[model samples]
Target: MDFPTMGDLADKWLEVHARVPNGFMKGRPFTQSDWQFWCTANFYRVRVGAEFVHPDDATDENPVLLNQAFVYRRAQVVAPQKTGKGPWTAAIVALEAVGPSVFAGWAEGGEVYRCSDFGCPCGWGEKSHRVPAFVYQDGEPMGMRHPSPLIQLTANSEEQVKNVYRPLSAMIRQGPLSELLLIREGFIRIVGESGDDEADRIDVVSSSARSRLGNPISFAVQDESGTYTTTNKMVEVAETQRRSAAGMGGRSLETTNAWNPVENSTAQRTFEAKSDDVFKFFRQPPAHLSYKNKRERRQIHEHVYKGSPWVDLNSIEAEAAELMQSDAAQAERFFGNRLVAGDGQWMDMPKWATKAAKRDLPFGAKVCLGFDGSDNDDFTGIRLETLDYYQFTPTYGAANRRTLWEPKAWGGRIPKDEVRAAVEEICAKYNVVRAYLDPQFWETEIDEWASKYGDKVFVKWPTNRITSMWASLERFQGDVYDKDARFRHDDDDQVKIHVANAVIRARGLDPATEKRRYFLGKLTDHQKFDYAMSSVLAHEAVCDAIAGGALEEEPDEYVYF
Candidate 1:
């Protein structure tokens, strides 16, 4: 269900109080760009003053009030560089600090909002620009200021924190907001009756650990989350702030450029999370456009920076080209707003994403199976590939036809019976000609399968063999990037995540012969790559089946009904 928003009030409030922080339009009344307004509107959207009741079964006998009426607990915006994230964040901070940001109740009609009503000196009757008024319409949502707003402006480092902090200071100093806000050396305090009230202030929080980090905050702005990672402990800081905000019925906003997938940064994790309470806005350029091509790169820039008219396409192109001279992937990620992989990434994610054409395989289709197993501390899964090479896990099928199984999801051990039954069911439904089973920890199961199904159908394909595994990986990569490739996979989220998590690991030169080989490894110990391995084994089985003539076409016979 959707709710009415206080975006109109917020917009008008900023028009009277906020100002452009810097550049040629410095000190001018701030106006939101189209994208900025959209984000703000969605973030502020909230429920009316109504008690919670189950939509399926509701009764006046029992109703519960919600702790917070916000539709989203947090919001993230992923955009290109120089897209006005800084000034926009500063404006939001100011709004949270003094403006009517919280949902109050529904208005019947003929009500007006005045700065004097909230203890400010501004008024609508004043001939000057300090006064602002908001006339409420019938049934419109009203807004109220937080009594004590404690905001945190955070980033990976002190220098990065200035991205928002500097703009905030400038806006407060250059506008009517200066009358109510007291700009300090490291923070800004919202002036109260006694003046310089410490309870209502916006503080700069950087990567350096602070003792008061867990203090309950009214709102928080996480800047440049793309660089917040475990190494600097910024990820932990972000989590801490959110937990504190939840305690105070507050929310957070994260702003960043597109991130490197391999870094496992905060922005990447937030973007990939399956939580329904988080709002995300990322405008990516069309997939068909190539960032490496100069002409196509310009098109990408134009698309990503569409709403922000301040960004000069020519300037962006020149900067991207210069950056591309050394770091093309970073350039694309920063300017193209694309999720590009860093060094040692085994697969190109954009190419893989482009190949997601999921379709149902007809019943009784000739297929091959691949299995990778683990007892615990990792994933166990199976992948299926048709004879003509359309790969997918049976998870998309009926509940009983499970193919991929995770150990962590099954009480820290693989569900042996369920897996065996699923395999048995698949074998009965499809004409499975070949199956490659990695027999590292499941040798007994593999042997039993070989006995139940013919030995040729189920073979122990050990993956530790560097020579063979490397060759199979090479073949899979070739097909994925090939222009006329026949390989395609199901639109499985697990497959995509596992594939993205894989990194290249060198085996160095062979001891007996000076031969070099490489294999896939996980980016981190906790990140699993089993599904990717299963995919590689499945493709290898398809190749071996074709080589052995197991897929030879049979003559068709027609029978009249």
Candidate 2:
């Protein structure tokens, strides 16, 4: 770990000048939490007596710039919503505006920093007003105010920028920060030595304004980067700010809540970036606890909300429970601090997880099987639903059970012989009441199976029919979310992964019913949802069996294989 960070000076400066922007402590001195202090310390970690130089510009002779002076060129902070990120961002902006924000040199000894020396009267030697002295120990690194700092507080919209700008305005107006800076509507100007001149300024920028984006900046704070996606054009804005900051040898700070992985947002890209000079801070909850379990969810809340003492666990629980009713993934992402696909997600993972059960049906139990087939470029799988409503795939037979087959695993083509053998083995192992086969690329196999197993047993079930497909999906979803329904499935991870990859795609309104219908679609071409579709077909088969009086009949005698 690196030592002698200028964050010590920053911490003291915020405490002396900054104030709480709102709530009960509105006008009190601002205090950094332990987590905030850690962020400040790491972001300000500097190479002693060194200057920043771009790797492209470094030659064998550039003395100060040759060394990787600054440990990090940029940094990102990921935390839960309302964890004081806005106020922390404001404090950072304040520090960059007038505090010791740049590298000066090494401290020899006995060098003290007093406000009086910096054209201010807030010092011990002053007649009524006084401030504490920051003594520089021997061999310690020193910091100085930027010569002409320019900072931008930016987001996707003006309202989003207020997340940072509003707190900053209040901080300056409610505390001693006012003496050093003047806060207007969208600008905070630092007073220069002449009292009337502007030394530096902080501007509020959004996606709507791009004129002043090219100006050289000392620092920038990008708030809510999770929403900075290419669709909103905030991705371009973030890239522009990085270039602007780099021009002046400055850096940026990105603060955001957890992001949806499918959106490919700026925060997601930043986290996935492999650059060593980018510092990332993300504290996820313990993996052992399942977010679907209500008891474990409270524990997860406690873990992720550790540093934020002001957060109320009971209040968070209420809000999360309510939000889970509509958007389970969002609740987990916001309160559980977990990255989950929220937008356009077809299935609520927590609801699906709640339906997970261990396979308990006896051997040779009457069951319905759903089959979806493909030759290549996709997956082929079978799902089983017992007469008692417990769903599972046969994992105990020979030949790897052959229940789930992926073309990629087998020379880019599904082995028809292996699939035939597996289907026969399943027929011999269980008293199959009904089998719904998609019969798209396997028409010949379906015709042969219908002859051998009876046409009523192996029926053609085409998934391309949007109307029936949508109805089946709706029924499965309702069963999963309805408390009164007893729908359950085997704890299969492949099924869960496929379900998570599924997204909703709406087709036009039905001609007869005049109601909009939707079906499951993959988030991307490579992310397969075949297993999830198979599960839905399996549930639909079970419903048909009950309606046709198959499950109502007496069970067949058990036969040992």
Best by TM-score: 1
Worst 10 residues of 1 by lDDT: 58-67
Clashing pairs in 1: none
Cα lDDT, model 2, residue 214: 82
TM-score of each: 0.84, 0.61
Tens digits of lDDT, candidate 2, 486-514:
88888686777678879999999988878
Clashing pairs in model 2? none
- Tally clashing residue pairs in candidate 2: 0
Tens-digit lDDT track for model 1 on 1-561?
145788888988888889998889999989999999989888887755543343245345542222266677899999999999999999999988888787766788878877766656656424454444578888777776676788899998889998898888899888778888888877788976344567788888888835559999989999999999998898999999999998877889999999877778899889878798898999988777889899999999999998899999999999999999999989999999998776788987777777777888778899999888888777888999998889998853465545777776688888888888888888888888999989988999888988999999999999999888988998998898886898888868878888888889998776666767799898677567899999999999999998999777877989999
Give the per-residue Cα lDDT of candidate 1 at 126.
43
Distance from true position, residue 104, model 1, in Å? 2.7
